[model samples]
Target: MNIKPEGRFQVFANIVMILITLIAIIPLILLTIASLTDNSALIRNGYSFVPEKWSVYAYQYIFSSGNSVPHAYWISLVLTASGTLIGLTITTLLAYALSKKFLPGRGILTFIVFFTMLFSGGLVPTYINYTGVFGLKNTFLALMIPGLLMNAFNVMMMKSYFVTSIPEEIMEAANIDGANEFSVFFRVALPLSKPIIATIGLFIGIGYWNDWMNGYIYLTKRTDLYSIQNLLYRMIQNIQFLVNNSSSLTGADKSLGSIPSVSVRMAMAVVGVLPIVIVYPFIQNNFIKGITLGGVKG
Candidate 1:
């Protein structure tokens, strides 16, 4: 029997997808296994699919710390949700306005928004301004407002989607029916913008969830406000410090020896990414569609 060209291509494509899926999934499997492996075994054998020894000390260390991990998770959740909501609102509003050709000063406004995509104020100036003028330092706003709040790239992406995907005639019809700009956006533009909105929202949510820089720089005294990333980082640093200095410290030897270092790092990786991995499947269809359709088409 001879295979049809389409059948051959389909078989090849399926195999390629299977390989790609394994490539993506294997690392996560290894990470979880390594996290569960005994610390001493990890040091002696390195990472292996079949660990000789198993341990839960890494998780116990992370979780038994008076609800710190869960609290950090909560902070990350709040930050992601709030940042995504506010960011989507601002980005969509700006992009919608910029998409309208008849709007006054449209060219100038578009140029300014585009300019930000290419360049940004230096870090020192940004820090000083946010700290001195905006006064967002050492607060929760420090995490949400500074950098992750919005992106020029996202604005441009949404603008392109609006211009290319949505028809101006439909908007005109809504306006002719006594609908104002806000009503048109609420009733028409937004409903048709699910793909881009979801894509941009996921971007913002991930950024906020993974951010440790804002916390590290701003929350010097507010350790309680540390997100999961920040808290995991601190745990690793503290463990490393104790292990490195265990010889000199009188009482640190027993305490440090009991906790798993190498395994804890792996365990932290699993914990940090677990939420995103769990949620990706739910929005993955929208995410894929947005990626394909969000940019300029035709």
Candidate 2:
């Protein structure tokens, strides 16, 4: 049998894609195996796919405190949900208004939005303003409003999707039929924006879930408000500090039992990313479609 050039090219492409897929998945597999491996085995043999022994000590240490893990997870979930919802509403409304070319002062408004993407007030000023003027310090609102609440990039991405994908002719027809702007937007524009909405929501949700800085900074006085990321980060930091200073300490081995070793850190990482990895499959199709259809247009 003879193979055509196209068939040969397809075979080469499939081989390359399979290689890339394995490259992406191998690290995750190793990380999982390492997390399950006993700490002693991990230290002795380093990370391996097949460890001589397995242990759940790390997971036990993580949940050793009664409800702390669950509480942090709850806080992270709430923050992600609330931030994504509020952010989507504000971004979509702003992008929709900016998509209309005939709106009064549209050019200036668009420029201001674009300008924000280029320059931002430094962190100190932002912190001062949020703490002093907004009184957000040590509050749940502090975590919800700063950083991941909304972004100029998301607004621009959504604006591009609205302008290129949605036609003005449909809006004109709806207007001609005595439909108001609100009705047109609610009934027509939003339904047509599923792909972009899903894309933005996913981005915003991940940002909120993974954010430890906001909790670390603003919630210094309120440990109860810490998110899952913040909690895990603190756990890792404490473990590292103890390990680094173990020699200097008077009773190192006695106290080292409270701290987790390498396997525990890997376990924490696995726990941190588990929810996102599980959820990605549900949104994979929409995420792919959104990126394809929502590209920026010149």
Candidate 3:
């Protein structure tokens, strides 16, 4: 029955992790419960974990508001998928190039990437450039191109992973075997770097999925292009306006009272993030592996 120090430490760590998991999950459980609770109960009791009454009226109000919900879902799915693939491709190519010490202008390129991480052209100029010059506003490109496409952080992480984890001798061997740079990269480098690729892909995917600012700013008149987040945001705004200005309209008081504004807000949160939470567990292993290995210095 004697236990080693390591065994005791392992048990303690498991206990700590289980407690942390509960702390994180309990709020989400409460949020879903609150979302399902009757709006009157929510307003009266202030979000009890176990409310007296339950209702799906919030979700009904949300979906019945317009035909926009399903369209928004499709738009978000396509935007996230396309943006992640394009962003990851660009990131991987740029990182692979920068990882080579002998590449001409490598230092200058690395400096530029690092400098971008520190500075930007400011909001006005960026907005003007993307909208006026590039004519990206009101287009799908607005969502995929403006800011979420690529960035220095992912590039650096991928570059660091390539340089530290991939062996120079292996690349050299491929070259000596008459393989071109493309061949070496495709056959030797990419296959061996699955963890980093999956990690960065997940990062880009989540960013695109959660992005609402792009749609809000660029798709003002292009309401059809609004993603799920943008649609829900607009719904929330409309509800708030109704609640705030209820005194102005003739029947606004009754209308506002009937709306499940309180519970609907929680329902929107659950809807916005539920898909990502469902998908994360599938790639959690590669993501953790990537972060761990890519962070090390040779």
Candidate 4:
């Protein structure tokens, strides 16, 4: 068949897109299959989609961590939700306030915020300040505060979006109609910023959901307060420890076959990440829109 140039190009583009989609989806399929494969099957067949045996033992083992798994999930959910809300609000307010051309000290404040993006007090000083000076250790504040709050880069994205996307005339008209600054910001400005807010919220939410460092550093003495990532890290460590000492374990213990193998680790990963996967599709449109609008424009 003699295809036209445009038809040939369309066919090539479709093939490339399909390939890219498969590349992204294939790993998730493998991850799910590997999680369901029995420990012995994984050991023998190496990570095949069709394994000799299958078991839910890995999931059972993960859940068997007592209340730890559920509690950690709760902590992660709370932190992700609260952190996203608080971070987005603060970022929007700062960005909007700075976007106002007439605001006093706007230039200086923007410069200061931008400066922090380039330089920060090193980890040691930050640790000392949070742990010793602020005494946020072993508290929910440890999980919620520190690195997860109010990113300078996100602030700048929001500020740029405000400056470029929002027309100055809209705010001016609102002001002329007796709208106070607070009313203008809350009613007019925020309603127009859904794209940037959703995008920044997703970034902040993911950060909080996946964060383990804050819990590791500040909640050292409080295992009960560990987030999902922190708790999962400990689980992986415990599994390795058991594997290392497997020889020392009695024969009966081994016969019970309670030790979680490679599949269990994959299962734990799926558990940790499944929620984010489920949530992403809903916001995908907004995420794309936000990124497109947030691009640097000359």
Q: Estimate each model's TM-score.
A: 0.95, 0.95, 0.96, 0.93
Candidate 3 lands at a TM-score of 0.96
Show the colliding residue pairs in model 2: none
Best by lDDT: 3
Q: Could you tally the backbone clashes for each prediction?
A: 0, 0, 0, 0
- Put the candidates in TM-score order, highest first: 3, 1, 2, 4
Residue ranges of candidate 2 with Cα displaced over 4 Å: 65-67
User: Of models 2 and 3, which has the larger TM-score?
Assistant: 3
Maximum-TM-score candidate: 3
Error of 2 at 222 (Å): 0.5
* Candidate 4 accuracy as lDDT: 0.86
Of 2 and 4, the candidate ahead on TM-score is 2
State which candidate, 2 or 3, has the greater lDDT.
Answer: 3
Clashes of 4: 0
The residue-by-residue lDDT of candidate 3 on 190-218, one tens digit each, is 99999999999998988888899899888
lDDT of model 2, residue 213 = 89
* Steric clash pairs (candidate 1): none
Q: Which regions of candidate 1 deviate over 4 angstroms?
A: none
Per-residue lDDT of 259 in model 1: 81
Which model, 1 or 2, shows the larger TM-score? 1
